[model samples]
Target chain A: MYQNPRAMPSAFQPVPALAIPQGDREGALLVAYANGDPEAAREIMAALAPRVLAQALRMLADRAEAEDVTQDAFLRLWRIAPEWRQGEAKVSTWLHRVTANLCTDRLRRRRRSVGLDEVAEPEDPAPSVAARMQGEARLRALSDALAQLPERQAQAVSLRHLEGLSNPEIAAVMEIGVEAVESLTARGKRALAALLRGRKAELGYDED
Target chain B: MTRIETGADGGRELDDLLAEARALEVVPSAALWARLAADAERERPRPRTVVPAVPPAPGGWRGWLRLLGGWPAVGGFVAATLAGIWIGAAPPTGVSSVLPSLWGEDVSVALGVDEDPLSLLEG
Candidate 1:
């Protein structure tokens, strides 16, 4: 199904919700992988790699680095399968945490390489062609705004909203209290709204 | 002021952004899963017994034997061998009595005893 931009703002276009799979099935698959089932490993990879890649892409804004993050995420996953505890934490939560840490470490390295004392979004960062398509401008703006948020808040918002994880799941992933998760997301959303307020027309909202 | 309504609209706009984010789908390359499978193949050698839940076919030649009549055939062969050995060593009570020549000698001759033990032997 295609959307005519004239018919409705892409923002208002109804979107089918992301299926947040039960962490238990994922947990069971991990157990299967731990027990050396290659099929199970394949299943886990298929199920999780896209989400890992998505989170990485949003965080790093570099395809090569995001791919690397995804690969590393899975490599670590392969190594940890044997020691994985099934019910203690959701598999997706653990994966998001792993990918986030990887992204943060890479970002830190980039900051150090640039000799900047503070980690900052690179100035005039060029979005890839695929990132700049018509409907995706909003995503790019949101991503840019996300990049500007304090790193923790950015990550919190990314996990909570972009990654479709619930507050409790994010709390488990971020290793923070649910109330803290609530605070971070609230602050992050408010900051995002303020940042993008001026660009509404350019970003193609308010046509209605 | 219109600012309050703007803020409310902005929040709705933010909600819309989140929905769009959810709509953003990224699929990993097929090669990624292949690489993981290769790694899993390599690293799967944990010391735990990996027996399938369905219980894999018994493994080597034992599996073959299982496929072909398992213990019953082997047990029958063993029983037959034991019976043959017992017969060669010492047959059952009636087994030898019917044919004394089968032993190749008169066992009574060894003791110099007549067929009727009640008769006194002539010197």
Candidate 2:
């Protein structure tokens, strides 16, 4: 069920769908959690928290705020577990959407009080200091560029390119139609490209 | 160095940046994981259908017997039931004599049932 990335019509192809088969497992674990199976709590965290945290971090570019969003998203999931209609929506997809929305809200609030320059670089604990600095710079540049796009566009693009979700999965996360997702991602990529055009060389991308 | 002048060039650069961003791993801290697990536990629904670790109370006669306060109560009930059945099956001499006294003559004769107009309607 994996579509070749190159064949995708969008300029920025989504990462392959190789790890997309966990939806069923996630749903089952959620049901188990709702049924009061204690171990399922840890299983749910293991299965989802990292990806959710990563998405939030990418969106907010602030570790602490991203953690808060991840926490809030999980709390919402926990509250909705008993009522969650299985097979209707994937748990991870729902979580991604919640996480994205939470990040968007925080972003809006942050925009009012703080400039994009104040958005700190997401911390990464790489072993090499130089490499870590370089990585942080690139990440910060990408995050700032993403911050410039509209919330939905940034979310769609991030889910498509950075998070590696398929177009349908992105649609599910965004609660929109597949065509809308495609359009958002296409337009998002164009906008992102334009935003990052001047910073390419500084970020180490040059004519090859 | 050629600058990104066309959409294709920018797209290529954007792809590289996205790839790098994707490669930048974002593992959750142990504290965050623990916090989420706590949230899960806090919000998890209590089991709706709890099967008793001990077997369920017996139904039917056993339940009825329990409700009646054990074998002693049941013994008294059984005794009373048998006594009533025996009395119905075979009346005592006193009971039989009393029944003739009450039924052989019209009780209206003693109680003046015939005097009452309502008694005529009843008859």
Candidate 3:
């Protein structure tokens, strides 16, 4: 269904390929690192760490935890450098998958320990307090709704909608077929819409 | 890219909120970068330095030294050869008296040969 980018709206268009390092480059860098090249290690980290951390932050909504997840993901990358098979997956996709799993584990633990209401809102560095509060509320609400989703659905929707990845890219990250990705994202969006519609007033959306 | 499916109620609002979330770029803090770099450095594989148990033996005749138990054994062999040469060149008086008797023993008698092998060739 997602094979044709032209058929989709511009907003659903694929992210610019140049924005991310190609899988081949990442794979080569990892091989270089395995061969004891420090520059390769630095280059790979510079290319991938921020995105990995951002994905973690989007899922966890906590910077400290996000940083931890990012670090853990990179450490795994470092350990896997020698064994990483190129062409199998993009480094970003692998890292995102790892980050998602880590975030899901933490979210599950947090749920067991504390109530969703007790989950702290993210601190946004917006220019004004009102904007910052609004940003925080939106993130907090989205995170809460996402937490309510099944793990795969949350990951698929986040990768598709928030990260702006193509269906094929989401398929690679989630290790599922494109049809499964479409099914999950569609169901996830419907659930998110339902959850958010109920909170339309609380989230400061105009009641039409 | 904001694709709000207007087909669903409040889809536009959801799309807007998601667009805003996407815009909420979480630039990794400098500290996070430092931490990652540190992790990369700490976890990088280092080249191994292999040290030989014995210093490499030199080549040619010197290479033979390894087979003959190295330089020390060669030195000992050289010393023994020189000692033999010196002893042969200048025997002690007591050794000279016994030298003739030592040489007097017939090779044919020693081997219990009835006749010399060279004498057979002559016949």
Candidate 4:
């Protein structure tokens, strides 16, 4: 199992060795994969699959759907390899764009399958008294707040804050201008803050 | 007291909320990764060497045409048609080019002109 360097609790951790190289990594992998190197394709997939899945889950709010979308995205990457232009954009950003487009398609199909009103909320587990008295309430509050956002706003917020992508990067992934990404994230944050404010007492958070 | 000060406080609160949200752990299951890898592998292209076309029977006109034309002939036809349309639609130049003179001496009866139009052209 690969350990995530970002998951470490320490303030300082050595950067991951498998972290993608800046200059030639995207071009080399794309060229090799296009030339029918399965190993090169697998390496790129391994590095990117986790974050892509995470982004899908945040968008779809369903583990099964997220897995399907991630698979579809990678499958598209394989098919599109021959047409890839070197240095047009970062490979990671291109994959993110593919994943987002897949998620959008999935959302559209889901809307047809089940009406928005009938879309089920994930069942919340009962919190123990001790857990509720601690940080669990805050976590639950935050999750609920996130669930309330409109789809694009939630996606922009998750990509920017949770995934740590810059505005330009998020714009590339979302297929929009940087200014639009900034607007979506800003509005998402404001809405989240408003939603969480009334539940501060329940969350056991100190007043500002 | 000022609009900028109020906006700064809002921004700080937003940052705090976002930081809290980011702390939540949400890793996808291992089985999901396995499925993705399998799908990617299935979609990977198989490389094949390009093979030369087999020659047709010695007496056929089809074989002769194929040898002469190939893809280049088809490409040339498309290029010529596009070029012809592009040139045909371009605007005509100079006033006289579009409106030809019908007032020449032999052509004067056609327009019922009494004298040469060039005589009127001497301003």
Each prediction's TM-score against the native? 0.56, 0.64, 0.70, 0.55
Give one digit per residue, the lDDT tens place, for model 2 in A58-107: 76667898899989999998888888777888887798888878877776
List the pairs of residues colliding in candidate 3.
Answer: A11-B1
Candidate 4 residues A97-155, lDDT tens each?
77766766666566556543342333454567555334443444444455567768767
- Model 4 lDDT at residue A94: 79
Please tell me how candidate 1 rates in CAPRI terms.
incorrect
Off by over 4 Å in 4: A1-21, A58-62, A101-151, A201-208, B1-17, B24-28, B50-123
| C-alpha positional error of residue A120 in candidate 3 after TM-score superposition, expressed in Å | 5.7
lDDT by residue (tens digit), candidate 4, B10-89: 35544554555454455657676567657766766655567757665355875665766856886788899987787677
True contacts kept of 2: 0.66
Better of 1 and 2 by lDDT: 2
CAPRI-style docking class of model 2 based on DockQ: acceptable
Give Cα distance to truth, residue A67, candidate 1, Å: 2.7
Reference-based lDDT, residue A37, model 4? 57
**Tens-place lDDT digits, model 1, residues A48-92:** 777898888776656678888988888888788878887888788
TM-score of candidate 4 to 2 decimals: 0.55
- Answer with 3 or 4, whichever has the higher DockQ: 3
Instruction: List pairs with backbone clashes in candidate 1.
Output: none
Model 1, runs deviating above 4 Å? A1-23, A58-63, A104-132, A206-208, B1-10, B46-123
lDDT of each: 0.68, 0.73, 0.75, 0.63
B72-108 in candidate 1: lDDT tens per residue?
9878878999999998799887878766666565543
